[model samples]
Target: MFRSLLIANRGEIACRIIRTARQLGIRTIAVYSDADANARFVRLADEAWRLGPAPARDSYLRAELILDIARQSGAEAIHPGYGFLSENAEFAQACADAGVVFVGPPPSAIAAMGSKSAAKQLMERAQVPLVPGYHGDEQDADFLHRQADQIDYPVLIKASAGGGGKGMRIVERSADFPDALASCRREASASFGDDRVLIERYLQKPRHIEIQVFADSQGHTVYLFERDCSVQRRHQKVLEEAPAPGMSAERRRDMGEAACAAARAVGYVGAGTVEFIAEPDGRFYFMEMNTRLQVEHPVTEMITGQDLVAWQLRVAAGEPLPLSQEALGIHGHAIEARIYAEDPDRDFLPATGQLVYLRPPAESDSVRVDTGVQQGDAITPYYDPMIAKLIVWGQDRAQALARLDSALADYRVLGVTTNIAFLRRLAAHPSFAQADLDTGLIARHHAELLPPASAQPALPALLAAACWQLTGEARHTAHPGWRLNAEWQRTLHLGYHGHPLAVRVTHHADGRWTLTLPDNSQHVLSAERHASQLTVHLAGQRLHADCLQHNDALHIYLPEGLSVFTLPNPYAAEADAQHGDTHLKAPMPGRVVALLAPLGEPVEKGAPLMILEAMKMEHTLVAPGPGHVAAFYFAVGEQVSEGSDLLDFVLP
Candidate 1:
């Protein structure tokens, strides 16, 4: 066992690696950028170093700086957690050259599987089942289009040099092939500095199942079962679970054997995932192999009772495999939900801001939270917006899902918008609960999955009113006799998210207050006053609202967000309503990757007009019209602020 190791990554994965390393009596060193100076992972490590400024290129992605830190800290090994430099072959070789072990696959395996095109060729040569596609070396535009034609329509164009749904696009027809290919190449070049892309026949109703395999320096490799990651949006996984819901014993063995074969072909070691795209009819095709630890490794850990990180450490220390293929056992079911700093209601736009309050559900006997952030930490736009991975284990899939739903509801994160509410809805979705999932699940149930703004609950205004009215009258005043002692002294009017809410408060002799909502329902509330905040309780819900009194208006804090309220006024009229508005604005702060719609071009209601790249994926801004484009407010490559105009058009 190694005495000390350095984690060449940041955020939750870094924190996760440190936890296991410490448990094995290994001291851990953490590297951080300027933006993450006070991050949770930094505090968790036994030693820490500043890599560089906030930009990833200057910090987390700098292989030279990371290698230097590991050498200076006298660390025996460097663990490159997923993302950033984890799959970078050059970084792995650099660590080896510097006499430091990289706790992952050998550099030779990474080089072979690092490029999608190269991996496809290798897999085909090794007799592994591969998806039928064009893996040719020719990058000519016409030649690629010819290959797409040969493969027929509905082909997937993916960046050969990158993963993570970054440089990937699906074209449904030959008419859209040319443009989609150009866009994919441009993004691939910008993201990975490689403009090469490959075309493949798109599989319909595909379930993403991956096998977790581990090997040791002694050339012993074994498969540890599989995980189903079929729940996705924009080709990115949202939820994952181990021991696929209905996988037969035969199918499991076949897939596991194939995965192990692929690993042996590349001389793979440590923890890695071999992903496959399985059709509805049970036929599975190799997608690609992740050369490092995955974000959802916890699910595999729960089912197999294995510490994958610990395995990596042992393997890196030149140890032989402790167990064989027949020795591994999997029990029960486990599921993981990726909680991100995004707004599902707003087309799943990435949100950036300070985290006011992040209260993840406390871990219980079966519940776990792997997080890289703390309360008051800022979510910047420089990297992935994933906040944490919420994982749960149970005796079966049903129990795991039930626990996940409950955990999601109990989670409370404020300051910036998140997908907590959205995840809660997804777990309860009928299709999802039934395990009938695919890449198009989010699109098929688009209306139900992403409800309009009107679907959001209107409780903020009511809560604001309750808080405003309850705190308006001070218990003590400048004049001693200003206090009033009636059954009920004040009726307060509060607003929540611009909605009016009327609340009446009755203070009892015991100091607890009773509040009546606009609907005439009454509930008891407890108050705990502080210098900056006022705590209130109703039913089983407790809220800590910050008090800000300005211009006779009081603001109340609700779980959804904060809202302001004013004094009761019967004469204040409501504004006129217009519901059929169109011409979408920027959902959040992002850069325009391209302008798909030309000036004065007529478009359908759901036509793609432009693409906004934010947080990591490409979001196609659609036209909610059957009218001609009135104007284009921004051009390609332009950075726009949140709510900045992208297009202006009148609906037909």
Candidate 2:
């Protein structure tokens, strides 16, 4: 094994690599950008090196700077953790030229699989089943339009050099193809520096299944079974599971062999994943091969009882295969849910802010949490807003799904919105529990997955927030005659979502208060506070919750969901003007990608105006009401802050 290794990534993957490296008695060096100076991964490293500014291009993607750091730190090998330069073939070749081992496949293999079009062609040659598509080099608009015509409607335009769902567009009709292709190419160029694309026949009701394959320099390769990642949003996976539910043993063997064949064709050495789109009728087509360690590798590790990172390290050190296909076995079912700093409502726009409070499920023999942020860390706009990954294992699919829901219920985060509630709902849904999955599952059950407006915040939170306020202001321990002259009751206003709720609390001599609401609902509740934690007793049941104050809002972490309450400003305020204003502003911080309307174009109520890209997704701003574009403040390709005025319109 090498004496030292450098991790060329950040966030949870970096921290995860360090954990395994330390267990193997290896010293790890971490390279970080300006945004991650005090990050958890940097603090966990044995030695640290500064890369550059916060953006990926200035830091993490700089292959030469990383190579210099590895050489200076005496790291014999470099681990590119799953993003940025993970699949960069030039970086792999650079590592080889510097006499440092790249803990991944050969550069030739990466180059072949880096392009989706090229990978599909290679897989076809290897006899691996492939989806019907066009992979020609001519990227002209007319050529693509004609090819789409031949392929029929409902085709997918994918970036040839894309992964993680960045540059993918699905068109249902012929007319939408041109606009989709333009958006797809723009995203492709911005993300991969390549504007070329490939058109494929989009598969309906298909399940995304990927086989985990490993190879050694000795030409030995083995399959670590398969994972089902059909639960997705925007073509990116939200949840992943190993030993796909209802998969027969015979089909597993066939897919496994095909995966091994693809690996052998590329002369692959190290860990990689061969992904496919499997039809419900059992036919599968090759999608693309990830040339490095995957983000969801832990599910495979949990099911196969093998540390893939360790395999990568040992293989890079010239070691032979750890275990053969016959010796390997799937022990149990495992599930992983990616916790991102995003709101499921409002179209799942990514959120950014500091973590006022965070508490993950306890880790043990069954539950595990892979995280890279501390409680006070900030989720800046510089990178992906992933908070952590929660992994659970059980003896069967039912047990695993049950454990996943339990783990999600116990997870807590505040200040920044998250999708934990959405995940919990999906994990416990009857369809998901029965293993009925597809790429469009979330969109199919949108209304069922999200809580109704009435169920957004439960009634218990109101009592909890009020109790917390009473305790924080030291009113709970007031004099015995507190209510003697106050008409035996006191009313306080608690703001929830900017609306005030008048709570009437009637103090009783028995240390209990009768809480009343606008609905005339009354309950005798008692609360005891110990610092920021509170325990409320209602009737015969007891409940505990955490509360904090930040951003002029009271953040309450409840079992149902995170609730925010604020004491609205009474002396300083203005009447809302959004109802009549004609100015268009950005809802979030992002870069203006394109402007559709000219300065004097009359747009309909819902006509597309401009597009803003943020946190790896594109959001289009449309005309709120019927209006004519009067002026534009920011042009395309300029970075704009949240709430910045982008356009002013004249009401029609």
Reference-based lDDT, each prediction: 0.82, 0.87
lDDT accuracy of residue 69 in candidate 2: 90
On the 0 to 100 scale, the lDDT of residue 302 in model 2 is 97
Poorest 10 consecutive residues of model 1 by lDDT? 474-483
User: Estimated TM-score per prediction?
Assistant: 0.85, 0.95
Q: How would you encode candidate 1's per-residue C-alpha lDDT over 465-544 as one tens digit per residue?
A: 44444455432222212345645445555444446555566667666667677677777766665644676676787876
List runs of model 1 lying over 4 Å from the truth: 452-465, 471-585, 596-610, 622-638, 643-652
TM-score of 2: 0.95
Candidate 2 runs further than 4 Å off: 455-458, 473-487, 497-500, 569-575, 578-581, 649-652
- TM-score (C-alpha) between model 1 and the true structure: 0.85
Highest lDDT scorer: 2
Candidate 1 local Cα displacement, residue 140, angstroms: 2.1
Clashing pairs for predicted structure model 2, backbone only: none
